[model samples]
Target: MNLKRINIPSRLKGLCYTLVIIISFNMIAPIAFAETTFEVSAKAAIAIDADTGKIFYEKNANTPLPIASMTKLLTLYLILEAEKNGQISWDEQIEISDHLLKISEDLNLSNVKLVKGSSYSVRDLFNASAIISANAAVTALAERVAGTEKDFIDLMRAKVISWGIEDAYLISTSGINNEDAQGRIYPGSKENEENLMSAKDMALVAQHLLQDFPEFLETTKLPSTVFAAGTDEETVLESSNFMLPGFYYYKEGVDGLKTGTTDLAGASFAGTINKNGLRLITIVMNANDSNGDGGLRFVETTRLMDFVYENWTYETLYPKGSTLPGFNKIDVPNGVDLSVPIITNDPLQLWHRQDMNKEHLTLTMVNSYEALDKNNQLKAPVERGQQVGELQVGYPEDTLGYVDGSKQKTSVPMVTNGATKKANFFVLSSRSIKNFFSTIF
Candidate 1:
């Protein structure tokens, strides 16, 4: 067909081309989606809710492996316990023993040089061990506390067993690789034994330490501090935990815990963070320097903390003294009132994913009466604030699948809000007669 030539305006042609490009981009561009999964370079790792022994995430957390200087955390625990029990004082002076002096002289191990005749306070030794992971300082403290490192190891093993940590085996007060000493282990030490622990067990140890001696954080959280200040032999000890201030990979919430490194353990960290009253503990073992810049433990720990804080949060689901939604009243036989009001004795705080649906959460009431009788029934003469049952809150198993026991459910005591008395037999009979006449009518 023959067609007449038509001229189009330049601006109109540009507008038409712009519209076509916008439409094509909209059609072909990838849709953005929220990140729900994460990966780390560590061989074994775990994240736990500090308040509750809840495991939020885990990867080979039960695999036994070398934990390096993280073993010092246990040593720190015993020292604090000793001090608490009046076994040792923080200001008590300890002379530099020959063993400690020898260990300090060895440049191959991390140490704070100790003058053979110089005496230091228990506080000094604790700061050196906690902040800088000084093996010599920690060993000296262990010797002071239990009379020998071997005895200290026995105490450590006993304490771990008491805490129900079965898989852990303690061979040293400090987590030094026994093999690194050219096959010459310390005197009284097993030839081939090394401190081996799983991430879960390590987290448990951390939990116990924090619960028993929260003051230890004062030493671990310091980015830099003086060990023997104002003396001619002054030394400055810096924290190896990079999550602390002034170091690379320093996160805002990380406060204390421990770090370990050895040929076998690689870079391992047991770190704790407090953000807006929500505390978390994370353990990363056998992590390597992915970029060869060092601080692989810190890098992985920071990543895990970032993921957790981004996805999980603590929420108070049920407040104390508030009546349960469906269990507001309980039957009271022969009482002044036919029923009495009941409520939770304490608030229920749960650590859950940020995107979790609060409405889907379930509450399981475990009656205290079940312990007394096979029939789940409470007797009259109930007193205010008397615990009658327990409230367990969590998502259904079908919804969240299998979750860690800590994160699975939060339990709180359910109690009565007011007293109820049993009515006399005559009053009960009169009420029954009136109820029978009303029913007949």
Candidate 2:
């Protein structure tokens, strides 16, 4: 009665506006984002899966510098390949060549004591090079493979280029060039020259190695294995890398590779680790700045390993026998009803980013069709696990990887079990037996 009838709407409007003020405050409050910072200062390094070559974490991964003895991983890989291909037998005896002897004696950091003219098995040379950064052993193997250490070095350069390792150089196999010795030596002298690699390139090299030489783990993980000490058993070799300490994270399926040092390159390492069917390779290059040797390389490598084990994780993308959407249906020949179910090799999961969702990642298909080839013999849809298509995820650029992508496959014939039989005589009247496929579809 006190307010005029015409003013009632305006008064209510003001009250409504006032009521909304309380809700806006609740809506506009800031969210608390829990983020922790982990700084990466290594020149370049990366961690990745051995099978997929999926990068997990990286810093300066493409920056190629002197990788030190980490290059041995490549040398080792080629040598192993040669053995596998029958080009070189494990028992094939190789003598210490002049150049090899020179590298062995010159690299003061580590040596397998390649006695000139002394014969050793290819296996011995490979073992020495991998177990303890033996320049002599690596050079001996390199020279044997391509006829000279120089040629082997050329192969190394070409391979690095192929592997997308831009920042690395392989002037020496042992990675034993002395940084301090550079000032006094000539341009190409061992003292003046050096090997280079960033953390990322080193990791890639390790990745290639593990993929190429699955057997390398057997030798590198011996914790402490002796090699080629005949007549001088005094020189029992050990893993210069102390990662297998009385108690360490490396013990859990962490296997081999090479370790390196030199005043110029600092300490470098590359190796593989497999746990719970999840395999990954980690490389640390120039992680240690101290040439005098305080073992910071081990300390830092362990830290990187810790970050990987704790902060990062692996997840399957698509499990076998699973049906995917979009790809919910697949194309198969003589597939009953003209449509076959789509299946994947592994369960689809956030392999690279276990913390993210499958819906968010970009999924792409790898096109592989089974048609009549020049000679067709009723191939039963190419082996079951054959790659027909793949699902790849696009991830952020800051991290080293975007790996969860995997191969897709056409489902096995549903009617092979004899399910495609005509349900009724009435069905035969609609179309020819073969046309039934199109009609039902």
Candidate 3:
């Protein structure tokens, strides 16, 4: 074949080339992020509704495993509480302890070298621990809070137990192995012990931290910050959570959470995201990364995110002042009115899956009556908005339940919709006489 070629202007050729490149990129960008089949390789994982404690998904979530730096979340919780309760202040300056200084100087750990006799504010230490996962910075804060790291571990144990986590195995304050603590292990604990918690337990910790301290995201969302800013020892601290904005694995709506890695723990993450007003907390523990890049945790967490957003939606299941079928009105025989209408005190909002049938959701009236007569009727006068009992929303039989492994029901208070004044004495006496005569007949 023979063809004649015509030369084009240089400027026109460059413009054509640019347009082609832009068109090609636009075509490929959407495909790169399109969803595909995904499987989680983590030993344990869980995704939960941050506000409602609803479990959206789980895999081997109850088994205990090492959590690495994710343990700092609990430490941060205590520090915030201490500050709120007047035990500590963000501006309070703490003198560097020799023990923490040595750990800070160790090159093997994640830390910023602390100068002996130097003082740092609580805010700086917190930012370093949170943003950089600096172990010694957190350990210093732990010591300052509880007077000793061992005592802080005790406090951590007590706190988790109070949250209904019975199987937490805590050793060091920073989630490092006891051996890494330089012979400063917790009393009676083995040298190799590292902080171990099931995915559920970690989810509970994340849940509590986010719920109790919504302001925490203010610090966790910072991609980079200067520790000891405007000082001679100023150091830059970058977040280990790559899912935040402006990172390689960045996902929109991902703000504050924690990441962990160790020899025993592989790589793990406790991630949270707020999408369209619905916030979810996810935990992936011991994720295997063949590339050894420690990014598999974020990848697995993204899978959990996909599972939730693709399969579930957050909406109001029931409106306020609505009552369950057949249980709408409670018997109040002796009041001015014979019976009183009852309803939910608030709206019932929860996470729902795409394939889930609304008809399958069941509401059961819990037996928690405050005051009842012999026949189960309200004893007398009932006040408006008085809580009569609880209404529990039941999920499917095969559901995995909550991250905490507690009951799967989403409970709301059932209350009287209006007040019922006591009946007059004459009316009560007449009703009693009529009841007695009818019984005799």
Candidate 4:
């Protein structure tokens, strides 16, 4: 082979062009296809629908596990709620304390460099905490909520319990590791004070968040963000979730959720995607390869979500009001004769079962119609859903959905509606006698 010397500018141009092609190729081929399931060995992991707390897949779902900065969800929840309750105004300015001021100085960390005595609007602080996972921003929020981080954490616990998050513990506002075993602090205290949550509990937290703090969805969907750059040198926050664009499962509906990382917790992620009308939330914890890469978390999230979307198709079980024939309709003596609207308050959730065929059913109706008074308790021992009406609807033995199959009776939940009627002595005596006999019958 003969070697010829090339011009400097031309050689440089050719090298640059070749490098661009190589980079493009690598970027284009981000991840490969793999069989999807919930086979991850994470300490705890779960995937659910944010709108509906449907658990698509889970591993160690009820077991408590260390969650890194994903603790921000709780912090974010309290702050947003406080804002909603008029406790704090988004435009209101507030000063930072020593706790937040110190955290802002941590290098390469998500800090807005908020200065002491330098005031910021609640919105700014809110974005900083949520968008960047700024430790200082959340700590400041904690202080505002309950006068101190310790007390604020108690408030957070109360809120979590209200949302049904059992077994999850929040020790730090930012979920950063700290070794201080102070009595007042929540359990994340021994250089291991990351937020602790299980897949099931986290799902509960997420469900509550979606119901109340839906604005969080807007912030997390951003692939990148620019915050406080003018004041604090304009810190740019690129999303740590790389699966946003150009991924198979990732589409226009992918929005913001929390991500986590720690030596103990590994790379953790809780992400959500809304496609068409179906929305799915995915969680992965403790899937590290010792390479400092978030590959396992990414791969697991993708696999699990893909499995759920592909394997399980949401089917309509029993719809509202549509009656099962062969049942006698009671004559409404005074009220209008309309078929009492029979429906499930919530959809019947099923996994790995898909039969949807109709079968024989038996519906037992009890007279919840009592003298409706006050906020209208039925003035009886029976509560709202204590079988006032039951439809022993036939269900399938096994199917993708839990709809009726081979003539098996499934109890349906029906609630009583308050009545508006003039309660005279005769009406009261007749109803009381009817109720006593009905109970016995």
Candidate 5:
């Protein structure tokens, strides 16, 4: 039998080679592709370090989806901020406006009924909103904080923008659909439009709330509280978060975050936990509960959390005194020494996954060299262990990325390990004269 020889096009051959290499790489190191390895059932999901805002895993986290009552998280944030700024006191009494009373009386919505002519303390309204996801309580707080719910919506927009989030669409203080706002919708948003935010945005809001006003957790952890105890309008407010201490889906370290659900936003959760000092925040949106039990979001959150706890650990990625290959030193022109060695000032401790390929990690120098010369060289008289700049630790496959979207990676201080002494006046003069001539030429 005669075998016929065939000629392959160069482009096709190169493509074939690339495919083979990719296949070989995948087979050889499946652990490196951590992003694609795990899966969570949700429209958008994310897991992050609550303290550092370092993202560990995410699925469709950047896409803005209906966040439902999670809108209240922002409302809660503004309320706490107002209290901190002395704009409102926790015990300040707010009268039930007819507009808010109308929403509160709606038995269909999650709310604590407010008597038409009654007043409730800010603490009561905050408790109702945080514990039970009460729409009217949140609306009342919004009105009190900004003099109107619409202005509060504007504040929410401004707050998210200040945090580097641009995709958040706000319409209701309670995260209710605009159509469900009962003629009390935000000015510009169209009717029927629900509040939409990316999972990352929700995480960012939660991070700010937890980091800035940690005391808010005091109310959020409540399993049950009375809205207006010993009063006619009194109602029991039970936390919607099933993962709290007393709930069936309870996880040990879980505490104080928020949960949201609506027709538009199926069931979403922004849950946080601090286990052994390593705090984590996980956001899951649009989770499905086939049996209509509303526990699916919790289940998905648990899965995501378990994945993180099992796979990731708090450890040093790069130790102190270590130097990166390319960014290990800086040229010190006009110095006794031509160059100065640089090393990490502190250990780069981060929540990193186990068995991850270290080859995928990279350290890039942050360009904050104020002391650099015209040629990007450090000026003389460098002190030992002087901070020249920062080195950003990077992982390109992190699809969900940091909560602060503008930052590409977590940064660590990069400092000089050895001092670069200033050169003598004669040498400096010679160098300056040579540079002047070179510039002219």
Candidate 6:
């Protein structure tokens, strides 16, 4: 039988080979890809786990740049620290310095119109600085704490250093742009200083602030409040942070943080959100005011928060009394029972990307044997609920090598489910004889 041979053009043959090669390359490649990344119109940004200090997402996080009014957070930190150390009292009256008043008047900077000869309580000043980003109130608070704005700035630098944050520099207590429209240093200050901080360092500062003075949230969360109520100089100061209530970008869990803006720094924000026992700190710096609406910082912050909340979720890896798979029991040597059921005493929760399914999850036990030889088996006298090991849950990559930037392992304490006592001498001897006979047979 004669077989007919089909003829094809050289270009068509080359195209067929190219298609086959491309198809083979795609088929051999791994199906899993990296998580989707959202676009942020900011110079730098970061999102961190407030509890663990784990970084979830970052862009130019370590590059120090002007943080604008966000510097008030550090100043607030100093004030709160002083209050905690008995160095300052909330109700103690603070006299506005002539220097601060002059700066407020000459520069026409953002202020609560603090009266020059007015003596406002520390609480009132704090409210103005925190809620409205009042420049004069913060400067006055700094001067009260450290005797001079320059000295207070020194303290701010020292505080950031003590927190192991090296990239931050404080020139003004209020984080106002110290340069003029022509980029020249504004006169009347001892030196030309601008507050520069990286997104990561800002997150660290915010974490410290939240942990140290969680009570500050009571003031920052307010959209508007009276600065000095029941007084002649009473003025209604409103929060510049649009993420709070009464603004369009407000979210239920968003509370107590700060916003910043200047020609140099544009718009920036150091925001925090607490939801379902998970608190996250997000910082976005130098976001553009694309629409000139004057809320780009808040808009970017809201976007970052939404992305994080949508892509990540908290799940209980192991619940109490749940026996670990592949490790249902542990051998209890010289005990009343041959083995005891190994179970977790407490639940283990892990924050991870939502795409990771439960079926792909893995758990590994890191056992601690007190008195065991080569086999590392448990000894008798094992009490119920006694911690014997730790169970770690994550993906295989996280469980094995624990790659950085990947999901972190959540470790749960494992314990014995039942009590076990030492076996009697007679029983031990009988078991030894039986083991020897069985080996011989």
lDDT of 4 by residue, 104-207 (tens): 88764556787777877777777777766777887887787789888887887788777656577777777776632223346445554667888677766766
**Number of clashes in model 3?**
0
Instruction: List lDDT for all candidates, in order.
Output: 0.75, 0.57, 0.80, 0.60, 0.79, 0.74
* Prediction 5 TM-score vs. true: 0.84
Tens-place lDDT per residue, model 6, 1-441, is 111111211111011110001112344554452455576778999887776666666888879998888889899999998999999999999887776666556454677876777899999988989998888888888888888777888888888888887777667788876652123232344344577888888988898888788898888889998978999988888888888878888888899699888777877889999876678899999888767666777877878887877776666655668876666777776787888887877766665665544554556666654434356667887888876666656653222122122344466666788888989999888888999999999
Question: Positional deviation of 288 in candidate 5, in angstroms?
Answer: 1.7
Better of 4 and 6 by lDDT: 6
Off by over 4 Å in 6: 1-33, 49-56, 178-193, 274-278, 291-293, 332-339, 368-377, 396-409, 423-441
Worst 10 residues of 4 by lDDT: 11-20
What TM-score goes with each of the models?
0.79, 0.67, 0.80, 0.67, 0.84, 0.78
Better model by lDDT: candidate 1 vs candidate 4: 1
Model 5, residue 151: distance off in Å is 2.2
Determine which window of 10 residues in candidate 6 has minimal summed lDDT. Answer: 12-21
CA error at residue 109 for candidate 2, angstroms: 2.8
lDDT for residue 241 in candidate 4, whole number 0-100: 65
Q: lDDT tens string, model 3, 1-441?
A: 111111211111111110001112243433222232445778988888887677877878888999999999999999999999999899998888888888888887888778987899999999989888889999989999999998999999999999999999998888887778877888888978899999989999999999899999999999999999889999888899999988999999999799888889988899999886668899999887888988889988887897787887755766778876656887788999988889987776555566655545556565443456556557678898877666656545337677666664565667898788899999999999999999999
User: Which pairs of residues clash in candidate 3, taking residues 3 or more apart in a chain or in different chains?
Assistant: none
Clashes in candidate 5: how many? 0
Stretches of model 2 off by over 4 angstroms after superposition: 1-36, 164-167, 178-191, 229-234, 245-250, 289-294, 316-346, 352-399, 402-441
Clashing pairs in 5: none
What digit string (tens of lDDT, one per residue) describes model 1 on residues 71-133?
999999999999999999988889987766877777877778999788888999999999888
Tell me how far the alpha carbon of residue 20 in candidate 4 is from the true structure, in angstroms, after superposition: 66
